[model samples]
Target chain A: MWKALLYKEWIKTRWYLLLALLVTLGFAGYALLKLHRAVALMGAGHIWEVMVTRQAVFIDQMQYVPLLAGLALAAVQYLPEMHRKCLKLTLHLPVPALATLGVMLAFGVAVLAVLFGLGIALLAAGARPVLAPELVGNILHAALPWYLAGVAGYLLGAWTILEPTWKRRILCLLMSVLLLRLFFLAPVPRAYGGFLAVLALLSLCAASLSWLSVVRFMAGRQD
Target chain B: MTRFAKLFFWFLVLVLLLWQLPWAVNYLLVQSRNTPFTLYSEVLDDFVMIRHTSDKEVEYRDRAGNEYTRRAFDSLLPLFYARQLTADGRFPDSVAGRPVTLREAQIASFIFRSAPKDLNRPAPGLHFLLESMSGRVDLAMPSDAFRLTGRGIEFIDMAANRIDTAKSGRFTRMLLRKGCRFPVRELSGNPSARKEYDEGYLLLDADGGLFHLKMMQGRPYVRAVELPEGLRLRHLFLTEFRSRRTLAFLTDESHRLHVLTMPGYGIRRVEGVTFDPERESMTIVGTLLDWTVCVDGASAERYYAVSADDFSLLDTLSYPLSERRIPGLSFTSSSDRYVKPRFR
Candidate 1:
């Protein structure tokens, strides 16, 4: 039953996942290309010096790519279910409704983890050859909050889209925006170091928020 | 489950309100500090201030409340307003009964500023060792960088994108011979080539001992500086100012500002004041006679005028600054480079 449920989620989000991967990876690749251009124009040593002395993170262009991808994934996975009332049938399966929702969220999160992991891996690989390990770590640290924002965006999008009524969805959205704003508060690289672990935990905890929407949907709460 | 979810939602709402309400109030009503531009006048033996009046007119006054004309003010702070004094033909033949020249004033004067954000930031773990005696009029940025590890300093040659073991060994051996502990704690240097001179870096070693490292003529010149008794240095700013009177401006754990003088590497505390580099901003305007040090604090701007030769407090003044702000929760601060939640 779990396998079938996971398969159903895969069937629903597979194309969207591929598109998200391509878009994010394209942005990441573009950032790498810019770094390459920097190295070509003014030697790799110059690039290293700028990064070290000036705190220049070349991957800033990819900051919002993960966020947009996450938002899109949530929309792709949940909007159709809500639009066609297919979520009712999904909940009516043999498995418990909460478990069903959990499995679906788990699937989305799993796929996003892989996608974000790939983005970070590409960044690390591209930066390693020309830069020192400290610089590579700095670049990675700079991108961590943005990647976490992507995950938050997905979870918040799910929470809002799965909500039963218009009025409640608006409330959910205001809260989501405020929460998403937290991830982008500071422009300094690695400024979010001490807070990131708590933030990531909060992002993962946010997955439970969708269950509130699900419970409201189950209770037939409508505007 | 519904109850828990409902509780969580309200909790988030409360958090948002707590964060935003005070910030909004503070943002809308916060008043700017009307701090004056102040400097010590050795001729008057008093602090001079140039400030804007309520009508937005410039007013020059001494600490004794004696008003001065703009020309008088320039003459009083001759070293500071040297060009203006020269243009007005009011450049004095002597100040404080000592014969002085514009060139002498320029060479003896220097301004040093230290901010909290610069001291309370993350280190990049990499440093460039420029050739201290490159024989060029202008300094050049190095092609390699070094990082201190548990064992020794490792230089990474950027062109080859690998560790330059030979150069690394040379530096590491020099530091080791000077009895520098492995894995330095905090290091400070101005690596930019735009500066007048390069003093390399002042590093605090693992055991809290101080050391200076520089590359001179393709060889490592390392020296371990002996700390003054009971002084544990917390922050260091390598000041290679044109005057070159001091090696660095440092703060000890007691929050006292000290000047690391050159030639002998002697440390002299700037008496009668405390400056926490992690919280306050400090500005020092020094001339041949006296130095005026201004410490910007949370509630007031404190001024301490000291003798430049001895760093003894000559005079002191302060302006109580009242900023009408409703303090609240904030994750970002002007006083720091880190992003973490803080409340005030």
Candidate 2:
């Protein structure tokens, strides 16, 4: 039953996921290309010095790509369901309603993980030749929170889309904006540090928020 | 599942409210406190303050409520405004009954500032060790950087992204021979070529021992600085002032400020001054005569005048901060770089 639900979501969002993959990877590749071009123009030493002394992450261009990818993916996956009123039917499936929504949220989260993981791996592999391990670690640490925000963005996007009433959806949207604001609060590299784990947990807990929307939808709540 | 979801939803709402409401109120209600620019004047034996009046005009006064004209103010702080006095042909031939020159006054002056945000942030583990005796008219950045490990130090060539084992082993051996422990707890250095000179870095090791490590002519110049008994240092600021009289400013675990003097790395406690480098911001404007140390604390901005020779307290003044703040949840702080839930 879980596989069937997962397959349905995949079939619905496969094409969008492919575009997301290309767009995200393209942004990551462009950022790395810029870093390499910098190295080629003005030796690797300059790049290393800037990264060390000035906290230059080099991949700053890709900071918002993951966020947009997550938001777009959530819209592609859930907007159709909510628009066609298919969520009501999906909830009435043999499987439990909460379990059904859980599977859908899990699928979005998993695909986002794979997409963001590939972007991070590309950055690491491309940066390895020119940067030392410490510089590479700095870039990764700086990018970690942005990638976490992608996960939080997806979950909150789903919560907002799946919400039944227009007024309630606006409230959820406000809350989501404030919550996502947490991820980009500090501009310093690796500023999230240990707090990143808490952010990841909060992103996961955001999964439950969609269930509240589903409960309201089941209760026939409307504007 | 629905019950749990509802509970979690309300928890997030409460968190958002606590974080946002106080922030909004503070943004709307709080006004920034404009602390006057102040300095100790040896001529007056009191702090001279330059502040803006309600009419936006500049006012110069001392703690004794005596105000002075702008030219009189310039004469009061001659060391600070030496150029203005010299240009006006009113420069004193001697100050405090000692022969002085414009160049002498300029070279003897330095300003040192440290804020909690600087000390509270993440350190990029890697450090540059420039050649201190390269015989060049202008210093250059090194081609490699080093990191401290459990066993010793490793220098990585920046261009090749490879460890230079030969250079690494040389410095590591010298550090080990100096009785330095592995995995330094705290390290401070001024590596810029713009500085007049380089003193490399001061390292606090795992065993609470202090070591000075620098590069000279492509070789290691490591010295194990002996600390006073039970003196556990917490932070270090390597000062490369033009005076060349002081090496570094240190703060101990008990929040007392200490100065490590040059020629002999003698550590002397700056009497009657306590600066917690993790919470407050401090600035020291020093001259040949005395230092005006200003420590901005939570509730007050305290100033101390200490003798430049012995760092003994000469006088003290403070202005209480009156700006009100609404306490609530804050994820980021002006004093730190990290994002964590904090309530004050």
After TM-score superposition, the amount by which residue B71's alpha carbon in candidate 2 deviates from its true location, in angstroms, is: 1.2
Q: Which ten residues in a row have the lowest lDDT in candidate 1 chain B?
A: B1-10
Local accuracy of candidate 2 as per-residue lDDT tens digits, A1-223? 8989999999999999999999989988998899999999999878988998898998888888888899998999999998898988899999988789889999999999999999999989999999988888998888888899999999999999999999999999999899988988866788888889988998998899898888888999987
- Candidate 1 per-residue lDDT, tens place, B232-340, comes to 9988899897778899988888898898998889999989978988899999888888889999998889999998789999889999987777767787888888888
Model 1: per-residue Cα lDDT at residue B54: 84
Tens digit of per-residue lDDT, candidate 2, span B1-344 = 77877888989989999999999999999987888999999888789999987799999999888999999999988888889999999889987777889998899899999999998988888889999999987889999888889989999998888999999999999998999988888999987888888889999998989888899999999999999999999999999899989999999999999999988899999998999999999999997788999999999999999989899999999999987889999999999888889997
What is the C-alpha RMSD, rounded to one decimal, of candidate 1? 1.6
| Predictions in order: chain A TM-score | 0.97, 0.98
Leading candidate by DockQ: 2
Lowest summed lDDT over 10 consecutive residues: which window, candidate 2 chain B? B1-10
Q: Which segments of model 1 are wrong by more than 4 Å?
A: none
TM-score of chain B of each: 0.96, 0.98
Compared with the true structure, the alpha-carbon lDDT of candidate 1 equals: 0.88
